[model samples]
Target: MRVFISGYYGFGNLGDEMLLDALRALLIEYGFRRDELVVLSASPKETEREHALSSFKRGNLLRLFAEIKRGDLLISGPGGLFQDSTGPWSPAFYASHAFLALLKGAKVLIYGQSLGPIKRRVNLLLVRFLLSKASLVVLRDESMSDMVPRNKLLFTPDPAFILSVGEVSGLRDGIGIVFRRWKWDLESLLRVLVKMGFPLTLISFQAEREREDGIRLSKMYGLPFLTPSNWAEALRVLSTFKLVIGMRLHSLIMSAMTFTPFIGISYDPKVRSLCELLKMPFLESPRETFAFSGYIRDIMIKWDRKSEGLKCEVEILREKVRSVFTRSLNLLLGREA
Candidate 1:
């Protein structure tokens, strides 16, 4: 069957790419052809690099409509798709885009996704309308479920659970710290980690970087700052890093999938969910506690203890993928429930 995916993909952000990665693999395993999978990405480069199937710019409405019309199934695969983390109308990006496919008469399935505590009335109504059109929907958290309609599509872990294949390594002496907005403190983190002899590779995922936010932090702790053009390269770079400290969900998710001893820096409820899945502990960014080096030292010790567990987690993840592919495929093909 021809399938199309729409979400915050195409950005070199690891979390977003992992979802796309996981969803595509599941469909293909269930017998979809590589040529049959399509994605709406922010840019074409991502489609070429990380995405194996056809890809397009998410902003191109006419193209999006055309792809959906051609697809047998349209999936808003995983991540916090329905939330407004970026803006008041952000839910529309996922909902409306997925809705376009539904309007085209595609079987719309929203799997491993999230609903939100809508900050606005319009967002809530928009969510209701968009979700009402879905053939299947699974909100990742219970609190989010109440805000969304009861389609019996209540919950699943983020698609990262299904996407993480494994960690590859070629670390080149420098570690990277990738973050989204409102997640890190630049100066204090630099001083503490660098003094402890940590090498540097600073990264950010905000579409626009605000130098002002990290003024004191960057100047005192001079580090190489960069951003990946999209996730395909990010994964390549991740393969080169010794470790990662990340605030965005995808960055951290990618690091874990690679088995890097990552320090997840967000306490957002969604973030907490991903961490729990891995049985990993995370810090609340720069403010969560003091004696930063000591905290990290302790976590490092625990990571060594739990490293074997990560291998086991990978096996469990693979099993879960087999089940989801079996179930979703059977339903899509009108087999027994």
Candidate 2:
């Protein structure tokens, strides 16, 4: 079976990359060979290098049409494909891709997709029309159910919940703080974390670090300066953290897979939604982040899943994921298993 996935595949975001990784694993289990899975990769070079298993194709209008027509099963999103409450380009663009794929007669499955505050009427109608014909719809949150009505819109948490952090060498036992989105106030937050005896590693993005803050943070805490451009290396650093206080969506999601404790600093509903699905505690308003040390300390005591036997919460999540994957795969294949 050819399983075509439309996501932020070419985008350098670590969360999107991790979600694709999880999707590939699930695809392997769902009967697609490694060669049969093709990604509409935005960064073809990064996708090719990091995702060595899957086939990569440039995600253009032509390539998009071609992939949809070619694949037997086209799963549009297990990433933040349809969310645009935060951005302008993504929601309509990705949803249109999914719509076109469905129009082309592909077994379009909205897997682990998060619905959003769509502003465009055209986009909304397009999505509604497309999703109405979906073989199966697996949404990530309860909030999405009100917006997108599907006969099979079964709820499953984000796929990242089931992800197991890979084996890596450089990961030391330290606290991971990913500051991709909160670049504006990251300095203050970093200072507070460092002041509280927490060693930090800033996950750099397109924005350059302020020279003053960099010097101050380095001098004060003597923390590690980790700048990973690729996703796998990012995960390596992510796995090293005993607990991750992450601002980026995927950073929190990735942390959850390691079974490490996560404190989410979210600017989007998708972030809160993802945390809710994983049953992870979130650090909501950044205005209150200086108080996070206490919150972390208290939670760590109760975040004792590994300290004891297998946690019941994790087991329940695992079963839910397996069921979603099974049901979605069966429905897409036109089989009632």
Candidate 3:
């Protein structure tokens, strides 16, 4: 199969990179070779080097159209690609490619998509049209079900939940802290964690502004800083943590994949949603973070007591997510099994 996959690829975001990795693994299991996957990426060269897959500049219309003409299927998403809250132009920009690929006669599958927070009529209209025409639509959470037709949409956990971790070095004796731009006061919380004798490693999942923020915070607090050069490195780093406290979605997801307990700091609904799905404690408001150390202490005691059970729970979630992806792909391929 000649499959053209599109998303926020080529950006140095660990979450989206893991999404692509999971999709590649699933496609390979279905007998699609690496060479058959063509990725539309912002940095095509970097993507080709990293994934060993053919890539084209994401917004290059001629190249995209050429790929669309040759592709048998267009796999879009497993990310928050259709949301406009990130920007006004995002919905139109991301949807245009899928619409064009459909126009070129390739079957389109929207996988693990999180729809809305879309408020504009024109953007909603475009999104509705695209979703209506997609061959299969797999939404990442039940909250997204109201946005699309019940007949076409299937609910699954986030694509990252299906990621399989390889062997990595043993866990280190420290806390892994993942933070993004938020109004929360973290200095007090950091001081409390430090006083408790846990060494800190600040993790940045996005190489853009989040990395810069992590560095600044690390320097200001005298903590060590780590921003993984790629997705694999990120997963490896996550595996070594004793525990993780994160505001970024993928950081928490990686923690779950690595079987490490995490305390989520919600800056977005998606973060809160995932925390709820996992039945974990989260701080919804920034001020509540002042008492975070107490929350961590209580949670860690419970976490240590339930480590084996937690591991099993995460594995069950992984299997469920994998099954959903398998079913979605089969439907797209018109396979009964």
Top-scoring candidate (TM-score): 3
Predicted candidate 1 versus true structure: per-residue lDDT over 1-337, tens digit per residue: 6787777776555566667777887777777889988787887775756666788787888887866664378878677767665588788877777778777878888787756646778887888877776777765556466645564454555556565443465444556777556735545666667767867777765545544444434565776666666555566666566667777777766666566656677547766666677777677667654655675676555755554566577567657656765676577668845
lDDT of 3 by residue, 26-144 (tens): 88877888888999999999889888889998898677776677338888887888878778998888887888888898889988777877878899888888888987888876655
lDDT of each: 0.67, 0.67, 0.80
Which 10-residue span in candidate 2 carries the lowest summed lDDT? 204-213
Worst 10 residues of 3 by lDDT: 303-312
RMSD versus native structure for model 3: 2.2
lDDT, residue 261, candidate 3: 77
Give candidate 2 regions above 4 Å deviation: 53-58, 120-122, 166-174, 182-184, 204-222, 229-232, 277-279, 300-312
Best-to-worst lDDT order: 3, 2, 1
The better-scoring model by lDDT among 1 and 3 is 3
Candidate number with greatest lDDT = 3
lDDT of 1: 0.67
Candidate 3 residue-pair clash tally: 0
The alpha-carbon deviation from the true structure for residue 41 of candidate 1, after best TM-score superposition, in angstroms, is 3.1
Once model 2 is optimally superposed onto the true structure by TM-score, how far is the C-alpha of residue 131 displaced, in angstroms?
Answer: 2.5
lDDT (C-alpha) at residue 244 in model 2? 82
lDDT of 2 by residue, 1-337 (tens): 5777888776566667778887887777777788887787877776767887554554476766765564477778786566556576676677666767777877778888777666777666666766677777888776556556656678786776566656733444557766654434666667677677755675543224433454455576676556677556676767776678777777775565555667787666777876675666676665776567776776566756632222345557766787788777776666775
